[model samples]
Target chain A: MQYQSQAVAKLYFTAAIGLFAGQILFGLILGLQYVVGDFLFPEIPFNVARMVHTNLLIVWILFGFMGAAYYLVPEEAERELHSPGLAVLMFWVFLVAGALTILGYLLVPYSGLAKMTGNDLLPTMGREFLEQPTITKIGIVIVALAFLYNIGMTILSGRKTVVNLVLLIGLAGLAVLFLFAFYNPDNLVEDKLYWWWVVHLWVEGVWELILGSILAFVLIKTTGVDREVIEKWLYVIIAMTLITGIIGTGHHYYWIGTPEYWQWWGSVFSALEPIPFFMMTVFAFNMVNRRRRNHLNKVAVLWALGTAVMAFLGAGVWGFLHTLSPVNYYTHGSQITAAHGHMAFYGAYAMIVLTIISYAMPMMRGRKAANSNRSQVLEMWSFWLMTVSMVFITLFLTGAGILQVYLQRYSDTPLPFMVVQEKIALFYWMREVAGVVFLAGLVLYIASFFVGSKDPEAAVEQAASPTA
Target chain B: MTRGGSLPETSRYPPGDLAVWIFILAELAVFAIFFAAYAFTRMQHVALFDQYQATLDRNAALFNTLALVTASYFVVRAVTAIREGRTASARNRLWAAVGMGGLFLLVKGMEYAHHLGEGIRLSTNAFYMFYLSLTFFHFMHVILGILVLMVLAMRTAAGHYSAQSHTDIESGASYWHMVDLVWLILFPLVYVMH
Candidate 1:
């Protein structure tokens, strides 16, 4: 809000929320398909629905990161964005491409869509998350290039703060690593090996730098903590992140046809991955405890701290559970992976996007500091509902996974996959119910924006949060 | 970091910034896990480990240990020198520590070349896998420690440290000691333990 060009983030934030809703809806559909088997039948098909769900999640999170950068870079650099016009143009380009891609997934059979999109020339369509056609992938590269150019120019043209520098490094690392997606080796092992350079390197590796910088920016504003203090810790946290995360790539190399040393290397390193997250959790709490002023935006601070704890639990604690090569031997592709995936994504990435949105959205709309008390109350309601529901979903999937692993993979007389799945259908039913509650929370979250536009920001509360 | 205790000067606790201590503890925890993995795996394969343990060149490892221990001694001298306002002496001590670190790396590098000459790799066998992985990991730490010592040496030469303001020296010294400490454990567990 300090710079006129910061207004452009409003457009990207709105799109991110819209696509986030679409993702959760598709997620609910996928969850139902898990329990009911043929509920959607061949009309929408489970595979296509899953693709839509995951692809939408990635697209929306990218939208969120772009929006965050647009808002943050201007303020951190003490200047306007280099070109807000290009920012808006790229938003529309990304949105339209995202929409057309989703439509193609729904309308055409996946293989036929692959053929129609000229998959023969560069066959990148059938991969797990890179399910986008080669043309769309090229479009993504173009959009990313334009976006990086805009942000990069703004940082170089103005004062370079540590936050902006770290973010630039992270964003640049993201673009460079995405080029790995194009390297599709015919050897499945090699293919899987490099695929992690895109996925694991993003979430665990450089993306952490982005997360630390953004969280540092928010803490500086809300807690009035010293920038030097936050910047120093940011360096330590990101250093730990890459130190553990880079070699932490060894975890994935274990079962893949890699060398035997990965067993020790992967276990030792990935087991330490939780340390950075644990430090993040401690750092967030410590900053809030040392706050100088009581900011009006209590909810944003809540979202920030909530993200820290949940990310540690979901990504750190849960990840540590099955990461040891010995333990992974029994639970490689079981529902345990599902349980970890659901919570880790929601806690780490999804909640971060929501945190920045919560902090910036009110100011972009011309509010003084925060949303009205009513809106914040409802947002906190949504926060707990969604977060708690996710916990339930993870626990249910974990329960189903343990049972499935025992009955199907571990027992003396092992049951077949389908039989074990049938025995574990009850957990799936409970998960569907939790997924419904989550949808309700998302509805409340969106409704909060509209519910109190006219009301003044909330008066200061006297009681501090327990951790604070 | 002690609560309700004497202050830093009096207590001599941990001897550096809490941030550096956090990293030091994390690094130690990782090495602890690696050692545990080595011990647990050794328990399962005692004969293989014992048979391969003899193949290691103990003379080179013993010399590397001496090099690291001497480097740590020099770091302690550098910190003490800075505390006494002896800038030139501190810079000389730091450079001496860096030299010792170089000696360790040179010896370790020769050891690696010997292993590679024997066609041994991380995948050759479990014994070789843990041995190479653990030693090479500690070897990287030695290189990093030498870089730190060189930087500290340059800064000391430029008069950046004083008797009252030498926490950076303590922090660097703390880290180098950690690198040395890990090798002390690794040398015995991987190279000498039966």
Candidate 2:
């Protein structure tokens, strides 16, 4: 609201929410297919729907990150954006390309879509999470470049605060790492090796920089804490992140035709990855507790605190559950990976986006600072509902995973994969039920924005005496 | 800065920035796990471990341990010098500490060269894998410790810390001690505890 260009973030955030809802719908469908098997056959097969589910998630999160950068960089720099016009243009370009890619996945078979997109020239399709056609990948690069140019120019021209610098570094890193997606080697082992450079490096590596900066910005604004204190914590947290995370990449190298040294190196470093997240949780709480002013945005405060805790639980504790090579030898591709993925993505990445959105959306929408009490109450309700259901979803999948691993991998006479799947159908049904509640929570989250638009902003301390 | 400095010194709390302390704790936690893993793995391969453990140069390790311990003692002197407002004395102490770290590295480097000359590596066996991993990890900390000591020396020359305000010196010195302390454990655990 302070800068005209910041309004462009409203468009990005809105689009992010829309795509988020689509992701949940597809997620529910995928969950049902896990139990019912062929619920949406022929027209929407499992592979296609799974790709749509994951791709939508990645795109929407990218949008959310871009939106968060657009919103915070200007305020941190004390200047208007360099090119709001370019930002708006790239927004549409990225959205349309993303939508078309999803449509291609749905309408065309995998092989036909690959051919349609000229996959013969550069074969990057069929990889999990990097399933985009080569053309769309190129389009993503273009959009990322333009977006970075605009943001980078603005930060360079304006006041160079730590928040701006860290965010730019993170965004730049995201773009640079995505280039690895194009390195599709013919050797399967080599392909898998570099593939993690994109996936693992992003989520575990640079994306953490993005997450840390955004959480810092929100906490600074809502708590009225000194920028110096928060920035110090930010530097230490990120330093720890890189120190542990870079070498932590070895965890994925195990079983990928890598050397035996990776087992020792990977286990040693990755076992320490949870420390930064623990520090992050401590940092968020300490800032809020020492807050100078209690901002009227209660829900934003909740989100800021919730982000730190959930990230620690989902990404930190759950990741440690099977990070060791010995443990991972059994649970490598099992549902435990799925369990960890769901919570880690939702808890770390997804909630941080929602945290920024929750904190910034109010001011963008022309409120004094926060939403009316009714809306806040509803938003808090939605936060808990979504968060608790995600916990259940993760737990149910973990149950199914442990049972599956026991029956299929660790048994004296191991059962076949499909037979184990049928045996664990009950857990899948429970997971699908949790998925439904999550979708419902998403519905309420969207509705919270509209429910109390006309009411006066809720005061921090309610009026004491009524005057006639 | 948040809580410790405000509390009375009688509280027996740490004497540096809280942020660095958190970092130190995390780093220590990592070393602890690595040590535990080493012990657990060594239990299974006691014969291989004992066999390869004999190949290590105990005299060189003893010399490195002494060098690191001497460096840590110099840092302690540097901190005390700064606490008493002797900037010149602090600078000299930090230099001595860095010199000790360099000596440790020099002796350790020769050991590494000897091993490489024998064509030993992390892939040689389970014992060598852990021996090289744990020692190299501690070795990197020595390099970092030297760098920290040099920076502290430079800052002391610039009069950045004194009796009134020397948290930077305390933090840097404390980190150097952590490096040295890890070596104390790492030296015996890896080189002598067979």
Candidate 3:
């Protein structure tokens, strides 16, 4: 169990570092575009870059979940993985598929891929890869299947612990939800209906399951919290998630020509969606406070704590502020949406993924513990840098959205899209600056992974075992 | 195995079950929102909703609901039967419950096919959209519940579950009851309210 966990840990660390780098690179591109229009236009447009950025964020997070699953399931079940060979095979297949998918995005001509994929986003003459969503969808499914099989078989054989059961249901949800990608409905409404099935359900629904499982894994490890205590938290978190999330999708439905009542339904439920995130924050901190020991892997704990705080701010508070029908009536589909997306994903899932990587790295390397005071300090800085920048970005974008909605959406003498676009130029520039700060944070995080310390005192504190 | 010899030994109904219940309850809440949406939307298109409701096979939904309710009852009976060492009775009741759940799904699939033949789809209209999403979602849960029952039945057959080791049965039953509870709401909203 220990050996396999370490192996999975190594895979996770590599993926995390790569993902953090990707995040910063794309963030910089996005940031610069806000300031310098045409910075990479015709060569690497915003649309294509955004696809890679968002999709990579999703992919790498999934990779982290797999790693966490591989590590925890065995330990929780008190057994080895059902098939380590299958696990290894699934990992490489997913990696190769992921690499090819991204490469295919870059290398394939936009027009050709768009034509082949039937994406009607643009003429695709000079566009990057936003037009080529087919390959990406296929890649997602393959990864989902490989992951489902690996984890599914393990749970099928192993003891059905709360951790494993929740993880299994969550993974199963991942698979069922991905089925939406295969079909291409012609009607835009139908198309979006299924899209929400994949998008909203996966993130707000199953992803909550994933978060619960990961949090459970961390609590059991770091605090030696009774499995019972940790497991109960997982349940309550998931319960809160579903209670709000199902209706939360209504937020997206507001402008999608769904019923008018959705405006009310989406707002009310989405306002409640933050409750779980709030609960998650309380759960993480309460467990930490109730800890029997004072040992700290500062980086891992930093990421975990950051997950709670950022999720509250991004998914909870930000989501609620705009989720109301009255407020969203103005802000829907604006850059404000982009701001929320950036912060929420980074805050909730991204940090959780990073936490797993940081937690598992030393264990994977067979280091008794990682003693990287310098890296931990750097990581701590990165968390704040990225978080603070995102808040700035969200603030500016929200301001931009309010202006856009008031002047453009509602006014009789409505400005043209380009006119409003030009008017919001300052906010855009501010976003770009904030993006740079975020990217700098990522740079620090990636560097910290490889160039950290392993001294004994820090190691002992990290692992809570002097011998380790 | 005593840690510091101070804490009591681990109890049977551990935190896992509570956690599972919490999760299950939250899931029910999401479905509640979904059901509420269906009701709210249905109210808006009351004429069309009424027309559509009249078209539905209430008999089918009612039967499905009754079957589910009965199955949930049998699950309780099975739990009691197991407790009293009535293994054969428990097994029979469990199999019957599983069969009824399957029957509900079969009837639902047929009804869905009928609706498809009548040109209803997820986005056919507001009425059909809610109908498909709500019932289909419920159907998926039924399928899941049936799978759980199958596993419990296998375990029961193998004598792997005893009164003390019956958390699996209880959890499965709780989930089945939830499925039934959702049907209780869905039946009136989808088929009977008009």
**Order of candidates by DockQ, top first?**
1, 2, 3
- Using DockQ as the measure, name the better of candidate 2 and candidate 3: 2
Tens-digit lDDT string for candidate 3 (B25-58): 6568767877777777777788998987788998
Q: Which residues of candidate 1, in runs, are more than 4 Å off?
A: A460-468, B1-9, B158-160
Put down candidate 1 lDDT per residue, A110-219, tens digits, no spaces. Answer: 99898999999987778889899999999999999999999999999998999999999998998889888888999999999999999999989888888888898999
Query: How far does residue B190 in candidate 2 sit from its true spot (Å)?
Result: 1.9
DockQ of each: 0.75, 0.71, 0.19
Looking at the true structure's interface, with contacts defined as alpha carbon pairs within 8 Å between chains A and B, what fraction does model 3 recover?
Answer: 0.28
The alpha-carbon deviation from the true structure for residue A28 of candidate 1, after best TM-score superposition, in angstroms, is 0.8
Candidate 1 local Cα displacement, residue A365, angstroms: 1.3
Docking class of 3: incorrect
lDDT of 3 by residue, A263-324 (tens): 65576578778878877888888888887765556667767888888888888887777788
RMSD of each: 2.7, 3.5, 7.2
Residue pairs whose backbone atoms clash in candidate 3? A239-B26
What is the docking quality class of candidate 1? medium
| Candidate 3 chain B minimal-lDDT segment of 10 residues | B14-23
DockQ of candidate model 2: 0.71
Q: Each model's number of backbone clashes? A: 0, 0, 1
